[model samples]
Target chain A: MPDVIQIKAFGMIAEAIGSDSLEIENPGTSLALKKQLEAQFPGLKSMKFSLAVDKKMIQEDTDISQGKEIALLPPFSGG
Target chain B: MDRFERQVILPGFGPEGQGKLKQSSVLVIGAGGLGCPVLLYLAAAGVGKIGVVDGDVVSLSNLNRQVLFGEKDLRKNKAETAVRYFQDKYSDIQWEIFPEFITVENAQELILGYDLVIDGSDNFPTRYLVNDACVLMEKPLVFGAIYQHEGQVSVFNHGPNSCNYRDLYPQMPSAKEIPNCSETGVLGVLPGIIGNLMALESIKVLSGFGKPLKNKVLFFNSLTSQTYEVEISANSDSKSSIPETWKDFEQMDYELACEGIKQLSWNEAMKLMGHDVAFVDVREPGELPPLECTGLMKVPFSTLSSQLDRFEDAEEVLFFCQSGIRSQKAAQQLQQVYPDKKIFSIRGGINALKS
Candidate 1:
């Protein structure tokens, strides 16, 4: 069985991806996951968001474990 | 019977906590949605002094979330009105008003006077400007922002070891890709929830009672009524990206820095309107109060793709919508097709000119 990771998107990221949460095949690394998501959602290509793996913001390309919950958090401009 | 008797009586947050709050001053940068509740609670909680800085005047549309203003307050400077309201109805906390936005020129001077800052600014430029200024000045910052149903709250620069906003999102998202509150729309209560949390964090940071959101960014979804947080570690690259000195900071141009697609002010856009320059209004066909400009093309963003042939001869194209959100999208889309043409989006669009 292909390992799957759960992704939670917030704000405009959620709107662009069409859903707040989704399941995708584990992309192994944080950078790969970002590329995969961007390839699927053209709207996200220009947008900037922080990827959090297991509730920790990832600064570098870190391996993502199977079944982990990853969050896509974007900075909000509105007050 | 003291006015702070209720809060002062709580265990672990007694006389000492009250005293701490009574001595700390906070500068709130924006008197809009989030600032209203933050200022209201901070003043009620007996913060020693509060400074309200906002260059915007209270328009009729601001009445929904900016509860500090009334019909009589419309057209008055937001900072001035907020200060006046607090002075008339709230505690004896000393109130200071800037009646201006926190620009780089005044950011250092403004932040230097306060111990902490609460950023409720609406745009990325101001947010980044405020964050860098607070980090440079070495002040604790309570940050809150809302977009539609979701909100984010964080405490940055709380200590030497704490992470700031730069560590969370290392790069500022291009202004072209993002829309403002007016463009996307927001629930009236979203800012209320986020702003109250910011106020709570301010009190926590000031009194040293509960754990502040230091090194943590809280994400709240009002739709699900759930809260989640991401642990922040100081990214060395992000930390180093901040300008080292006041001279370097003053030279920073936040607006241009955040712009991926070149953005022109109304005045700048007007200067290039004629000749081979094409001015495109990308708002909907019937958006409102038509833009009466010389040689302007009415190309709604929805139909921009099929109208590319219309701009075949133009050397430069400028896009503008009601508030410049859709125009930015249009400019980005067109820039991809015509890589050699100079495509720009007019900042703030027609609504900005109206205001």
Candidate 2:
């Protein structure tokens, strides 16, 4: 079994999903995990989120470890 | 006594939230109407450190809504006035003022040290920049915005429970599509009501007292005196999508994102106003203000994408909105789809046309 990654969202996206956190089985690569998340959260098809692994944004297809913290950050609205 | 009062009475606050407030550091962007109330209340509440950031000086028009200044403050920096006001009202609290507007270049550094961020800005670019910086810094942000009689408030990027602003608006709408207060006008008291809500949310977040609007959006309609709350959930697709660097932030140019198209002045658009040139309003039907122009077609911006086929015969197209921001975006989109046909936006929009 792959390790699980914890993710969270807020504001409009939260309103759409109706919850703040999701636990997904790490699928080895960020791309696979992204696909799994999209299937679970359909509202993100049109939205943009900065993907961060353990609070640091990752651009490349990095390997995911067990129990790593993942956050899907939506565009900010505050001034 | 109120629960808030009980927390105030504790050792640091002495029966008021003053002490907790005194220890708290808050950065307020924009000294306009919304900033006015946020500044006044937070200062009065005895917040310890307050930073006021704004680039513009006081204008006669702002006097109507910005309570922080008066006739004497005209042409004077807004951040300076706010600092002076807080200093005079509560000498005990430490206040700092940044007279320059917060920009993408300095936002992250300036916002990193603050405990909380209060957004009172009027534009989308600044708002998005602030949200991204706060999320990067792991700082709590109290968000508020007012359009006519409606206002919205939310706590963003506080912690595991926090949400970012982009979750609410995935993309920026062209500036021309939306009428800013400068063109549309607003009630003087609207910002006060909204600013107070921002203060309330900030206080809630700082003291960890009541249920903060974290991950939730609360909308207030002053016209009908109704309040609505919407639940916002975490977007799973957003996972693994955090912007990796500052360069990524620059990639999303909100000015271009919201208003992607290019535009020309009214005079420039008039040159092409013949049979070969098509004019599309890109505004809602009722939103079309009275304007005297020939060879113009009215199509609200929302439906412009779908109605593009109607103008297939025209060699060129011109788009206009109240301010020209939306029209530019429309033109940009049209240019992408029809690379051969020229699409132009009327700068300053219909308001300019009428002028």
Candidate 3:
């Protein structure tokens, strides 16, 4: 079984998801995982969030591993 | 035994922190509410070198929150008044006053010499410009902002773990969607709270103290007196591809970034209440003082994007939040998806609803 990746959303995104973290099987790539998450949570389509693998921001099409924490960050309005 | 004696006794910051602060240089943008507390605390904390950047002159209305200046200081440049005030109180610290607003052309060079940048700027363009420049220079930024009774504070670009402001807010809301502090009145202590937090974070970064909120956002709600902490992670979609042309940066006007959204003043929106215009309150479900409109609907800001289809039949839609910032962003998103639908933001949000 593939390791489950945990993703967290903050600020506006957190308020949208209505929860903090979303756990799912580690999809091969960040884009794939995003699509899967969006499919699961239809509300995610309207949100403009960036994917962060582990703690740092991943710009390239990177793969997600087991136990890694991913964050779906919305545009932070906080100063 | 001195007023700063307690702080001086802390580890790392004991003698070195004091010396670094005295020798360190900081450039603060804006001399308004946020800048006022930031400047005051930085000077009070004995930062050796301080620079004040702002072109606006002190005004009578600023007295409510801009505690650094008074009626007598009105008509004087904010930077000049701040310098004078700091000099009188802390003669030991060095001060530089820039009586001009930070522009894209000067933002980079002006921010280069400073060890840290504090963004008290109110507009989206200035904030983005500052963040981009700071990221390019690899300088840490202590950011603070206030809307109504709530405030946000964060530290960006301190170290390898640092995240730039863009990491949090990748896109800038259109100017038509957002309002300046002047447009939306801020609570007097809101900026003070956030500004002091900026100072605290800066000190932590400078002195290497307790875990700084590097890559994390701290939120304060004065209305409910509650605090929420959120961890910020880097985003993949950010335009890491820096443009090759200087004109590109200049032309990248944040005001025009998110288009297709219309803006309506409170009065203008009120006039359409009985018409086909639909009002959507995008605040949280439990957000206080539910918007009181005859034809208004509540769809918390977070859910508006996913629930866009709910208003399919509406000829026009109006978005609003506590202070209009979130609503403006919502309208921008709505415009992106529903090009045919006329989406508008209520300037000053619910605060203006009454007016």
Candidate 4:
């Protein structure tokens, strides 16, 4: 059985995925989540963003447990 | 009687805190939406010295958020105009005005003169350049940026366990990958709010009155009134990218470093219409009013790889799409195949030609 986690998308990520928040089966790791999300939304494949778990940004692959607060944060370039 | 009597009376931020602000200097880059509020508040807060750096001219569209500029200020240099206007209002504060954008050549020297830096720049190249320079110079940087209805604020390169902007997201997205406020449109209030938060952070960093956003980034959404903070950790990969010496720093080409490809306007593209250039439209087949130009070909981006041979005989290739975004991607893709070839993308694509 796969763990279900809450995902919060911000900025362009939200626009690309067409939602600000959603729930999906956990991909188990940060890198996997990025790959799965990119494959799921082709629009995201070309963009750059960082993934955070429970409010801490992960620079490398990290395990994801059920109900972890996963957030997709994209950098805003405008002033 | 102290001019800052009200602020000087605050509990933790009393005479000492006011003194810190009165002795500190800050360099503000870009005097647009975000810089206006930051400049005004910093001056009002009694900062000792302030420098304004902006190369752009005041346009009619800027009046909404760039409150410092008026109709009379139109067509005037932003940095000079803003500095003079605020200088008139606050004669006590010393001012440094640079009516030019910050470039790699001047970044280090310009930043070395100030104790702190505030980046209100609107583009990715300048943001990365400023962040790297701040990190290298060991100066505290107050950073703020806005999108359509959201904004981000953070204080970088401060405190013991400092984390810079690159630690949050190591790679700078290619130009046009994420649309800026000008392209996507922003509510004037969004930057105003973000800029205020940035100004507050700058004060905190300088006066040591409050806990600054060290190792953390604050994100705000105006439409939903939602706010969240993300903790950042130092990444060696990001730190390694910063130049260790002045020579290396000066040699860095920020424009090419940010993947900023050559983009031409409709008039410029039209000039080469009948020349030895191959104009390729990367839009999908049957996609609304097709572009009609001399020596034009339709090659959808989805099948671009399979159609590479179609442009083998052309001296140069120009790409266009519905909105110029995809066309940039197409140009980048083609350039990878023909590194020495002159490849260009039309800005705003067909929509630009029509409107």
Best by DockQ: 1
lDDT per residue as tens, model 1, B1-355: 8889999999999999999999999999999999999999999999999999986777778888888999998667888889988888765789899976687789988989899999998988888999999989899999999888999999999987989999998988865566778777777788999999999999999999999999999999999999999998777789787898999999887865786577777878878877899988888877777877668889989889999888889999999987666887788888888889999988767765654
**How does residue B245 of candidate 4 score in lDDT?**
77
lDDT of 3: 0.74
Report the candidate with higher lDDT, 2 versus 4.
4
Clashing pairs in 3: B22-B48, B282-B301
Q: What would the per-residue lDDT of candidate 2 be over residues A1-79, giving only the tens digit for each residue?
A: 6578776544334445676567867788777877776787786665555566765555446788898876554542322
The stretch of ten residues in a row with the least summed lDDT in candidate 3 chain B is B251-260
Predicted candidate 3 versus true structure: per-residue lDDT over B1-355, tens digit per residue: 7667877998666877877787788999988888988888888888878888986667677898999888898667888888988778776888888887676667767887899999997766567778877776788999887655567788998888677777777656534433456656777887888888888887777767677888877767676687766677776555473333456555554433444455566767877775677788899987656757466788887787779888788888888886566887788787777788878887556544432
Question: What lDDT score is found at residue B277 in candidate 4?
Answer: 88
User: Model 1 off-target regions past 4 Å?
Assistant: B261-355
Cα lDDT, model 3, residue A8: 77
Candidate 2 ranges beyond 4 A from true positions: A1-79, B1-17, B237-242, B250-252, B261-355
**Per-residue alpha-carbon lDDT of candidate 4 for residues B200-239, written as tens digits (9 for 90 to 100):** 9999999999899999999999999999999988887997
i-RMSD values for every candidate model: 0.8, 8.6, 4.6, 0.7
Cα lDDT tens digits for candidate 3, A5-77: 7877654455557776677778878989878877877867766655667656655578777788887654433
Which wins on DockQ, candidate 1 or candidate 3? Answer: 1
How would you class the docking of model 1? medium
lDDT of 2 by residue, B85-106 (tens): 7777666778787877676667
* Better lDDT candidate (1, 3): 1
Candidate 4 wrongly placed segments (more than 4 Å): B260-339, B343-355
